[model samples]
Target: MAERELDPTVGALRGEDVEDRDWERVQPRRISDADWKRFEGYAAEILRAMGMPLDTPGTAKTPGRFLSALFDSTEGYEGDAKLVTAFPTECRGGPDCEISQVVEGPIPFYSLCEHHAFPFFGHAFIGYVAHEHIIGISKLTRLVRMFARRFTVQERMGSEITNALSRILQAHGVALYLEAVHLCTQMRGVRESEQTTRTTFWRGNYEATPALREEFLAIAGAHTNGHRS
Candidate 1:
């Protein structure tokens, strides 16, 4: 079977205007005061239709609060400006030059499932072999959160992160692993409380070399097992 090509537009870190990007269909739009008022009214009506009492003082503002929280949670639509920057690699050429995987892990993230709008959250482990540059350590977390904050599926999220890292670093390899507990399953449908979803993505050399993939997995597993080094 042929390997799938990574979406070149998956990560907009190159300062590309993402308004028309297919991967990020939910473009940021102006939400005026009138829009908020209209949304709050709709929320209240929806709650009432669902038999939620909103007349009580405690519940009176629930609709507005709900709207605010929902919008706040999906703020990934507004891309992070800090993600656009990268620093030159410290790896020196010559006999001393040593290229290795750069891994950042246990990045806790919360995301709403596009299927149900219920939250599925967990930690992400990202590994990449830099070519000419390296991203800031903190930006890894932002990268994960960028996709997570949207209504997304785990598979797509992993792909976007992998592709984004590859694009930014022009990396030789990129690997991403995500393990999340979906409330959609726990709170509805089969109600499998203990079930968690795991997804992985590999690109470039990470996809070509099994040992490289395994090495990345080992590091991620060690951290997950609480043996951080």
Candidate 2:
């Protein structure tokens, strides 16, 4: 990954004070008055045109809440370096320390498919040959979860995951492998109902040699032979 100044926003997300709910709870996000008004204006008008009363007990605050929740779902749009930078930076530049491949979960993630606005849910495996430095294990999972909430497309998500890992670690190489079952496909009337989508990406040394790549994949627990087909 090309080096650049670390982003403060990323750090903000990783800050100690950020609520645990911010990353885990998929709740309705509070939206601005202006945005809510605009959304409700259209929603109310549409309901009125269809001769439905927007005043029902179950529906009165629905529009505002719905819009707020929708925005909240994509909250990863607010990406920052808070979590990544929170890791000690000393390990990276250490002159005499050795590099090692660190495999990170099986980090479970869920995100809306950009095209259908339906969910693509799955686990991610990340591996990086840290150049005398390594981040906390939880931070790796948090980072994957961050990108999962941010992007609409798996390809983009995969790239973002790869870039972020490589960027923050400034490693010898990084590798990410993702497998997801899209609700839109499996539950919806799609041809490949039984199939799941698989995406993988790597950067630096991991991208170069098949042997090195497979080594990392094995460490990252990429299921191959003798696994469910």
Candidate 3:
């Protein structure tokens, strides 16, 4: 990945002090207030046409709350990804340190399905071979969130995570395995339950070395299955 200045917003997201309430204040950078008003109008019209009473207890606040939640999930539209922070590698043992493949999380993420405008959500497991630099594990989770909180397909999201990790950490290899339950598939169309969409992506040494790739997959697979049950 091409080097760039670390983003402060990314750091804020990683901070323990940052709370869920803070997200309510975020506004979409691309959409204007006028545009939001227009959307609100259209949303209300749709609800009315669908025989939903705007004044009903169940449907009240749906227009505003729905759009707010949508934009909140896709906060990357407001430049969240650019805020990622990178720090120097540290080892207690000093100059001579072990280079290892770091496996991190079943970091839970939710994303909008670009095709149906629904949602697909699940855990993401990331593994990368840290060459000279090791990224903070919390930052890795934040990185996953930054990419996932947007309109995307599961396959594209996996590729984005792999590429971002490779570039951000300058890792020798990177792999991401994402398994998600897509609402587009579950709530409509075939409407199948207990079905999942899995996507895998890798680059650098992971592509060059078969063993490295297989090991990461094996470990990630175990983690995925454990979470599923």
Model 2 global lDDT (CA atoms, 0 to 1): 0.68
Task: Tell me the tens digit of each residue's lDDT in model 2 across 69-116.
Answer: 667667786653456543444554443333356776777888998888
Task: Using lDDT, give the best candidate's number.
Answer: 1
Candidate 3 per-residue C-alpha lDDT over 1-229 given as tens digits, one digit per residue, 9 for 90 to 100: 1233233223223344343213224544777899998998888888789888999897888887778888788875454433345566654443233325778888899999899888899988888776556777788777778778889898877876776566566666788888899888777668646688888887777777787778888888888888778
RMSD of each: 5.8, 7.5, 7.2
Pairs with steric clashes in candidate 2? 9-80, 9-81, 10-80, 10-81, 10-82, 11-81, 11-82, 12-82, 14-83
Q: Give the Cα error of residue 78 in candidate 2, in Å.
A: 1.2
- lDDT score for residue 48 of model 3: 86
Error of 1 at 177 (Å): 0.5
lDDT of each: 0.77, 0.68, 0.72
The C-alpha stretches of model 1 lying farther than 4 A from their native spots are 1-28, 90-99, 227-229
Candidate 1 colliding pairs: none
What is the full ranking by TM-score, best candidate first? 1, 3, 2
